[model samples]
Target: MFKSSHLPLEHADKKSWASGGASSSSPMEYPTPLNFYEKPPMFDVKLEQFEQSALDRLRILAEIESCSARGRPWDETKRIVSTLCQKHLRLSSNTAGGDLGIMDTQKEDERRKDHLSHFVLRLAFCRTEDLRQRFITAESTLFRCRFEEATPAERTLLYESRDFKWVKVDDVEKKSLEANLRATLTGFKNIAEQNDAWDRDAFYKVQWSQVPQLVEHRRVFLKKGWAYVPARQQSAIVFREFEVHLRQALNMTNRAMPQMDEDTRLTPIIDHLSQGFLAGVASDWQYEEGDDTTKLRAEQVDEYAKKHWPLCMRSIHDQLKKDHHVKHYGRLYYTLFLKGMKLDINEAIAFWKKSFQGGKVTEDKFNKEYRYNIRHTYGQEGKRANYQAKTCVALLTGDAEYGCPYRFLAPESLQTRLQISYADQGLQSSDIHEILNNKKGSHFNIACTRVFEITHAKYVKKGEGLGQSETVTHPNLYAERSIEFETKKEGPTKVTSKQEDDDLEGIIMQVD
Candidate 1:
């Protein structure tokens, strides 16, 4: 059992947890307090350590949330959570048939990590009701799984260590309640020695409201507003308490959220982590297997836009061509897409410079303000982080032409764009209507994929097009797959620098 004195009282005060204290020089100086769920508190961590621990825990919780939202089976969800805990958090599976020795160094480390990670995530998730609820559900499920798998001795130790004061029914009371209890309790009907079993086993007398799940399922015997719950059903009551406590904690944390805004570094990190949770997992673009983009030149962007770019990228390209300018977000999104398509930095600069020619942006102005951002996307400047293209969720929630068109565009506007863009490809009004319906139903990615299939019906092979099973995630993925389909129809080809420069000149002349 962890000592309460070692536990940080900072969490109890809303302001303290949100505003972490001065940077600790060593881990031993900053020992985390012990808790019921997480035993053996961790100590001595730097700011980076704290941030990373929080991020790791967030990943597990995010995965759990995703699994729940998708209605994945309980066994599969448990399996995934268990695997993640073992791999990332170093927590061992209680059901895996071996007892972790009390003095085991690795076991102690894992326990400390598991304990600290939960508190760290609490700081990030307490800001919103939606986030709090999601975090609560995922964390509750995780704790329940661990509890269920615990060995008999561990379970007894845990139950005794907790503050629960459940009272056991007496022998005379048990005898009187035996018939009702047997009928109401799950798995107690066919006992050969009913009285013997009833006498030997312990039952807690809880308020009827405390075990509502049992009452609803008719699994507990209720009399005079009292619920007679067996040992096996105690988990329901205990987990409910866990949920209530966490909910209250989160509400308190939400009150402290405004203070977090003052810390710019922490605020962005939290926002980004929250966004990542909503975005689901990152997509594997399979860039390792070299594709047609390797041989393509920047000048071929327009040609590729017509045949290979997804609806989102295609919309951005058309807007840039027609208006001869795009907003900052549109430029960032489209430039990133182009870079993903293997357009080098110099070619990207030329493409943007040409696109802005007939607009308000002059070449000198573009260089002064826009050049660094373009280079930054390619990891050639600033942070030099090779940022991946935004995911479907990111695009869906973005503003000012930054988001996915299928999600953000008005129904009529989307319909009109699809009609005009694919008019020669036999796009019917019914097709447009169906896409609109998908968008209404929150199947935005599916709607975009449907547009792709409709535009490239002839090129899509049997059982090869975007089906109900496959969801279009990244614009880059859409572009890569579309290019792959084209490459299948036509043999491999390469673009020379002369061809790229010629295409660039044509684009510039058209703009002029």
Candidate 2:
């Protein structure tokens, strides 16, 4: 069993099999400290973009490895690549062919070429110029032809003939690579066993993709089934060069491609990715429920949600309750929260999208309808409204995938619910009108009405038919006191209630 940061010290019990690694003095150095309320460093959106882009690149690279351009086994290789690209990256057979230059303009034979071309472009370049150069110059011999037609020996020969090189590692680099690989394998096992949405097949696929990188880093570079003689350290040189190129490509994507208004670009992608990951996790969360690490009993979920409902998912929950609608915003919020709390991204996404199964809405319809609403809730474009939710997930749970910075307790009210703290200053009375002056003749009142609906089953009281309730019937009082008595402070010698009530007729009663 791999060690967990949350597990209590084993000395408290005698059956301690796990070793506690070196204890650290600093809090940040540890994995998950309980009270991790540091200002979240600016989110690494670039990193996420980089990882996704790399996966796109890998799908094509794998195809190239499988197919050789020597023109022998092209037909069989083409079929394999078609399936792989379509399954993973949604590229069609014609598109894959267009990519490899087997044909042009996406014909029946050319569909594979087109799909492969797009994947390669996404992999190697941030701009069209680099993409053109890479496509034109990439080694044709590296493309795969057929897997079964050739024996392992023949396949190895073909791989060697392609300009693609693999090298044997020296003792030092081999040890380092092996250690890293071990840790990665262990991490994968832990996550898989937690089983929060990671299926065995999908888990294996992701793990397999990392193999080529590991192998290249470890083995000596191959030329003709023999080690290529480079003067000092050519393998390291090649690896470093590849990483540098990839980093630059990723940086360019961040700077140039996602340059639309925060609402238009980053928000939609974030919402989609977040929901995708959450749905994936929720589907798998139950798989490990009885395991040692996961004590998440099914029965406890409903109770936990009830007690924590107000604060559990403050922003999205409130939005859903009031609007009687949950679109993109609700999905993104819940998904991210799950991710922050250590659920796998794929599982989280699958779970959420699946949750909508009982509803009439299809996934596409749901995304189209709700995508923008979520982005708006995050205040992604810097527009500050009275009810706007904060963008930080960690504020709620210190887990980026699941933080909720806007929860508050209102158990005294029947509609006990979470809310973004607005302007409660502990003062009582009619000073509310003056305090809410900026909110006058605006949607702030409407926002308050919405909040009520969210906390209670209905924000507005139900009526016989359509129209809204009377103004006096609305629950939100702009201020507890009138503007005239805004300065009236309670003193030891305060006037009696009867006297104050009698004198109050002379106060300024400017009702809007």
The residue-by-residue lDDT of candidate 1 on 71-169, one tens digit each, is 568887788787877766655434332333332333445555566667656666777777787789888888776667666756666566666656788
lDDT of 2 at 36: 11
Candidate 1 global Cα RMSD:
9.5
Off by over 4 Å in 1: 1-42, 93-103, 186-202, 256-268, 281-325, 345-388, 391-400, 404-512
TM values, all candidates:
0.66, 0.22
Q: Rate the local accuracy (lDDT) of all candidates.
A: 0.64, 0.30
Say which candidate scores most in lDDT: 1
